[model samples]
Target: MKIIYRNNDRYAIKKLLLDIGEPELERECWRRKLHKPRRINLFFLETNEGITSLKYKYPQKGVETIIDVSQYDLPECGWIRYKIPY
Candidate 1:
């Protein structure tokens, strides 16, 4: 997945997800300690059905999550790509 920002930490990602009603994902992120200096990569894409999916991987914890955010209204930044991350 392509990272929107190289410096984005899990704290920022969790806050955004929580604000968007993704409490489960937010809780899951805290399952393990990401003490490394490396930041986690957050990947997002809009599906053909117009649903935007956000995904992230926690390699150290062996976990990953995908969030369907079609119900929420996301601000327009003129940078969201519809392509799915591979």
Candidate 2:
């Protein structure tokens, strides 16, 4: 699917999930390095072709990241929200 981050004009996702070493608490030093402040704020343009969901699985860490990008249906709002670690 075609995904574009509204904040930037790029047509693809960028700088997401740099390292999945171990689970770290929110606001922790390790976590900060994993997901930077700018990377976490994802707002996609509201379109039919927008992303519906995003899933990432790390077997070693036994961590599964699942984010439903379509739940917050803001009709005509012109944006689809998808935050990291959701």
Candidate 3:
């Protein structure tokens, strides 16, 4: 899948996972890192078929990450709405 993060640039999900680990691991890391004023927010964009997008919104910017699900399999955890606490 294609992820649009930070400056709305597109990135491959496989590459991102390679850099950051799995989704669960990434969420755990993010939860630990978000002990300050700044934070990142995650959201699952829902659609009739299933989750069509995954968004990560940063403090200063809008969505820092966006995963397009149309062409990829959903994560093993399944599609659930998430907003990682800061």
* Clashing residue pairs in candidate 3 (N, C-alpha, C atoms within 3 angstroms): 5-64, 6-64
Question: Model 1 TM-score?
Answer: 0.40
User: Stretches of candidate 1 above 4 Å error?
Assistant: 1-15, 26-40, 43-45, 58-65, 78-86
* lDDT per residue as tens, model 1, 1-86: 54331213455454556566545555544553332223435433333445455555455654344556556555344343333386
Query: What is the alpha-carbon RMSD of candidate 1 to the true structure?
Result: 7.2
Worst 10 residues of 3 by lDDT: 1-10
What lDDT score belongs to each candidate, Candidate 1 first? 0.45, 0.33, 0.40
Residues forming the 10-long window of minimal summed lDDT in candidate 1: 2-11
TM-scores of the models, in the order given: 0.40, 0.22, 0.30
Please name the candidate that would achieve the greatest lDDT relative to the true structure.
Answer: 1
Clashes of each: 0, 0, 2
The sequence of per-residue lDDT tens digits that candidate 2 reaches over residues 21-48 is 1232233434324332233334222233
lDDT for model 1 comes to: 0.45
lDDT of 3 by residue, 1-86 (tens): 33322222233434333444467545654665532223222433333334455455555655433444444543443333334343
Point to the candidate with the largest TM-score: 1
